[model samples]
Target: MTADRLQPVLAGVMLALVGFASSFAVVLAGLQAVGATSEQAASGLLALLIAQAVGVIWLSRRHRIPLVLAWSTPGAALLVSSGAVEGGWRAAVGAFLVVGALILLTALWPRLGDLIAAIPTPIAQAMLAGVLLSICVEPVRVLLDRPFLVAPILVVWVVLLRVAPKLAVPGAFVATLVVITGYLVDHGAPDLSLAPQVVWTEPTLNWQAVVGLAVPLYVVTMASQNVPGVAVLATFGYRVPWRESMTVTGLGTAAGAMAGGHAVNLAAITAAMAASPESHPDRDRRWIAAYTSGWAYLVLAAVSTALVGVVSAAPHGLVEVVAGLALLGTLGGALKGATESETGREAAVVTFVVAASGVAFGGVGAAFWALLAGLVVHGVLKLGRPSAPRM
Candidate 1:
């Protein structure tokens, strides 16, 4: 193969590696937070990988665009904040199914998608920031108590941020693995199987899971991932097919839900690299990068179980350091988006505080409440202010 052909394949391979390595820990943490057992969480990771692979391959090839799909990282972070829902893991699975259905509904009804888009950017970003605060503090929290465990992770991340910013989280994750390995080796290995297995749970929906889990999950995913993904591709001169992309991702989310995956959607932050001129100077051929990413996800999926096994065994709060570190970059972006507009600053601050409080009322989670509070503040503030007169 010529250099051009090989370049995209390599770029795709790196995309998958960085994407998966940087956030898989957060995925696991979110699953466990929502009541998944270690094995179930591992299964969820595998399901998400397969769903992403299928979505990327189908959409990129069919549309002849470099379309990448991703598991919703913000949605996962929301799960971490929401914690265990009513009826435990099965209900959480039910919520995942609901998210998929909601996504499909959005695809069929453009109005529904528009409604999600209409959510104030500050409110949406504020909600995400609030959800991330708890997790983002872990490195500091652990650093004070177990500096030996977390310091190395932070040092590696800091070094990489300067040398190769894109690789920072992945580098931190590698450091975490090293620390965990040494701890495990010194303490003696536990008898555990590294083979990942698909564990299907029968889903049962309840109001709590739907309101607290599904609704918030759906909102975060659409607002953070799908919207940004479209924008990113547009900047690169590729228009994503909205209806088709939603359909594929919606179906992918539904298919993976039974195996415990949360949500799968369009890639945003990582989309630029794969779609850039760096992948290929010829714009039309850049789809090769996305297509290659699908196969790369499959290869990475092979080790999902092993990763879960190792992290699950690591001392409490230790593995979580990696997940927390993974979210810092995202937290920064969310905070910036939330605070950017002066008009919405007060409402956004309200939303962030409520979300950061991690409070639940009437069985619904903080994310839902935070949105309601922000909207109310936004509306009331609007009513008292003067409107610009028509020209």
Candidate 2:
């Protein structure tokens, strides 16, 4: 292949590596938080990888757009903080199905799609920024907590950002691998089998799980994942078929739920990696990166069990620091987008503060509340404005 063709392939691999290395730990923690055993957690990761691989590859090929897919990191964070439900992980799986069905409904109904689309861009961006603010601060927190291990990683990331902007995150991944490898060698590897297993958890829906998990999962997955995902594609001038993509992700999530996975939606941060100019000079060909990323995800799924084992053994804050480093660019972009417009600035700030506050009301997460608060503030302010003079 010519260098032009080869670059996208490499970019795809880099995107996959960063995606997995950064957040797989969070996925595991989320599963365990919801009362999943190690086997179930591994199965969930595998299921998610498979579903995202199929969705991303199909959508990118069908639409000729770099449409990357990701398991909802924010949804996982919600699971982590929400604690164990009464019906356990099975109930959570049911909640995942509810979210999937909601997304699918949004795709099938034009009015629903229009309503979601009507959300002001600044509010969506602010909500995303708020959702991500906590995760974005981890590198600094890690620096203070484990400077020896995290400091070099940060230094490497900074140096690469200056000298090779495209490779900055990939370089951090490499540094992380080296650190992890040395740690394993020093403290003998954990005794864990690398066998991939598919665990099916029958969905058991309850009113509590529906109100607590289903509603918040749907909200954050839409606000924090899908909305920003579309924004990322638009940033590179790709007019994505938003409804169709949502439909595919929704179906993918439903399929994954049977196998113990959570929501699968369009990617936000990693989508930028695949869709950016650095991935390919010719925007039309960036779909190649998405396709390659799909294949890479499938490969990762094949080794999901082993990957989870490795991450499970790592130091407490190590994976989080890596994730934070990978997300720095994305966080900066969200902050900039959230504050760029004067009209929406106050509402956006309200959204950001509410989301970052991590407050929960009636078992629902702050993300949903943040969007609602911002809209209420926006609407009230608009109403207070004096009517324009008649023509």
Candidate 3:
């Protein structure tokens, strides 16, 4: 088990970097949108890291589950949008607590977990595809805007993913860094500066924010994000306890929220690296990798907004193009897998359309709609049993 976990420990660091880069912007922006000073935001992000590490390590060790935790990208987006309407750190904290409570409560309901499992694999896959489609689209937009700059790298990435799947993601990141370096050589990139005085804001409580932001945060994090996250684990042959994992997610977010961070949840994309054969063949050993990732997250969280200062210095389009291209294979596979089966194909289509529709109500995201629609359709189809031919 020790040897099995060692290689994954290395890969886990890469996965953490990927997860951090993909969603840190949302964290920063959401914190700022909710009125956290640069320093307080940094502290909040650190708190988030602590929560994630504790959740992943404890849950993985206890359940031998290889669990991985991350802040919800969609939930962050929702929080930022919510902040736009319900401004202030107090509101954000209120929303965070509300969502945390909901996640914890949801975990208590065994039937809910069973219902989530009942979602046809194909339909769930379609929802995954729909959610990721936007991510995949960014590389093309980058190509159109700066074809001379991003095209060659995009081509190389796609080819590598097809021919050498294992190196696909890292290769893309390396290629983008090279391009970004070249761009910086000719045109100086943005300046990097540490915050003069770290800003910290005390959290306040607000009932309206709880309704407008908190509930939505929980719904989006769980229904849209965590559900598929578990599917990924199952797909890889890991049988994790849903309730326990959900509890960790809830507690993690709650801790982060107390420090002024928003929703956190199980990581789907980064989980693949740990779960994959490249990480470890012995499933039992993968926990070490998750353990290591939690530690790395703590370091990043401690560094706070300074980390953002460094990332902000890089070319934005470069990162987006690279990240999007890197995810292409995974997204394509997910989308294709979701729509492949005939039995769940139509439901899958509806799930995808509704999820990608960008609808929102009272801070809830499009995913809630998608999941709700899929469930209704799935339930109706299941219930509408044809009368047995008159015997």
Q: What is the C-alpha lDDT profile of model 2 across 114-213, one tens digit per residue? A: 6766878788778767766776788899889888888888899899899998677768867876787788999898897687889999999987788767
Tens-place lDDT digits, model 1, residues 11-106: 899989999988998999999999999999999999999999989999988988999999999999999999999899999999999999999999
Q: TM-score order of candidates, best first?
A: 1, 2, 3
Model 1 Cα RMSD, Å? Answer: 0.9
Better model by lDDT: candidate 2 vs candidate 3: 2
Off by over 4 Å in 2: 1-15, 18-38, 62-66, 74-88, 206-212, 223-243, 268-288
* Worst-scoring 10-residue span by lDDT in model 2: 322-331
Best by lDDT: 1
TM-score, cand. 2: 0.84
Instruction: Give all TM-scores, in the order shown.
Output: 0.98, 0.84, 0.72
